[model samples]
Target: MTPRPYLDITPTQLATLAPGTRLIDVREPDEFTGPLGHLPGAELVPLGTLEATLGGWARQAPLLLICRSGGRSEQAARMLARSGFRHLYNLAGGMLAVRATPVAQPQG
Candidate 1:
């Protein structure tokens, strides 16, 4: 009905992840590999190219968007929501908070 809504959650709260959750880092390549190392299994997909990258993903696919701060990731999550992804997650505070407080690995 309202399309897949964007869900904002802190990195720590996301520890208990479900299987098939896709981690997408929307920061620039340099930033992703520069200082704040990305999430454990995040794929580097710059924000500029996000739309094209989603071409092959299923509408129901789960996506977790990340960036330097919460801004870009939230934008990405909204973008995914527009694209019809049923499950969307935006990393609140992004890598900044992740660096301050380590994010737990996804539970099995």
Candidate 2:
């Protein structure tokens, strides 16, 4: 089977994602919830273990990967693409940009 390609998403664009979207933060645990904080529902799936955990992840849902400054997440996205993950996205500029963007609050 051919591998799928991943996309690059800016923080502003990330804010547009639907609530509850599966955001995979590929940073170390502390970094995920540390000084940078993290996306509201983003799960901590560090790059090192990402490949092993992919088997159990649902393929249909879009996966958004993030890290300190996008490098790690970019690698993670490529890894997922190689594994045939059809819908993958890397958070461009990572949390730094995410921190600068105004978060889109869920509409009531």
Per-residue lDDT for 91 in model 2? 89
Instruction: In model 1, state the lDDT of residue 93.
Output: 94
lDDT of 2 by residue, 18-74 (tens): 665698999999898799999888899989999889998777778899898989998
- Candidate 1 TM-score to native: 0.87
Off by over 4 Å in 2: 1-4, 18-20, 102-108
The global C-alpha lDDT for each of the candidates, from Candidate 1 onward, is 0.87, 0.85
Model 1, 65-94: lDDT tens digits are: 999988999888888887888788888899
Point out where model 1 deviates above 4 Å: 1-4, 102-108
TM-score leader: 1
